[model samples]
Target: MTNILVVNSSALGPHSVSKALVDNTVEKLKLSHPDANIVIRDVGANPIPHLTADNVVPEPETDAQKAARSLSDELIGEVQVADIVVLGAPMYNFGIPSTLKAWFDHLLRAGVTFRYTEAGPEGLLKGKRAIVVLSRGGFYSEGPLQVLDAQEPHLRALLGFVGITDVTYVRAEKLAISPEERESSIAHATTEVEAVVNQVSAAA
Candidate 1:
């Protein structure tokens, strides 16, 4: 049975385009693999605390630090057990949201998710697939605005650092441009999502 973990980090909550895409994707995955175990972590709704010196250092600390550590363990445990990870990452100010960044910070643990070797730092979590659903106000997949967009590339790099190299992206862009453009973008993204679902189903 496949274990899927869905992580949402859109401040827009129920009205978020990224969340909608992720929801569609998850529903398709369920259709394909009815026995799959799916878990959700809504970072935007319940934001994880940012990493502090106390939490990182791993020593005797206050109650807050202990709570943070426990949460980190739960977050990492979920990733470790998941066969596939789905992320709803919306661009904010040309970058990723702070809520997602905080979750990433907690997962970056030495001698756990990654470790420094003689050559360089090597990721320990391997053989995992990731699907990132991105929603952007402007076109950033290509053209002049691409350089200014840090959301996709940063997520790719960070996920790859944790050994999740098998990654796919479904993007809904040109939002906030016009109602027609938003509709077109969403329609295109929905098609892409269907294609992704077909591919994953075939693989299964």
Candidate 2:
């Protein structure tokens, strides 16, 4: 059976496009892999605290630091056990949400998720696939606005650093353009979700 880790990082709560897309994506994933075990992390609703000097340094830790360390361990363990990681991210100020970034920060432990080699840094967690759902208010996949897109690149680099190179992106853009555009974008994205099911099935 496959282990699917579903992470949603949109602070919009019930109104979040990214979170809804993630739900739709996961449903399709479940259809493709009926026996897949699902694990959920709703960081948007329950945001992870940003790393402080106390959390990152090697000095004697306070109770809060210990809790932070334990949380990081748990986050890393989730990624370590997942065969498929599904991420929901809505663009915020040309980048991903702070909660999601914090989640990534916790997982990127030296010698744990990655290690330094003579050749270069090597990712320890290998053989995992990531499906990232990105919702944006404007076009960023290509064209003039693409240069302003810091979201996808950051996520790709972070995931790649941890050996999740087989990453796929599904985007819903032009959301805030107009009502017609929003409807069409959502329809396009909904149709695109079927392709993901096919892709996963083919890999199986």
Which lDDT tens digits does candidate 2 get at residues 143-176? 9999999999999999999888988888999999
Q: Give the top-scoring candidate (lDDT).
A: 1
Instruction: Tell me each candidate's RMSD, in Å, in order.
Output: 1.2, 1.4
TM-score of 1: 0.96
lDDT score of model 1?
0.91
lDDT (C-alpha, whole model) for all candidates:
0.91, 0.90
lDDT of each residue in 36-92, candidate 1, tens digit only: 999999999989888876687566478877887888999999999999899999999
Off by over 4 Å in 2: 59-61
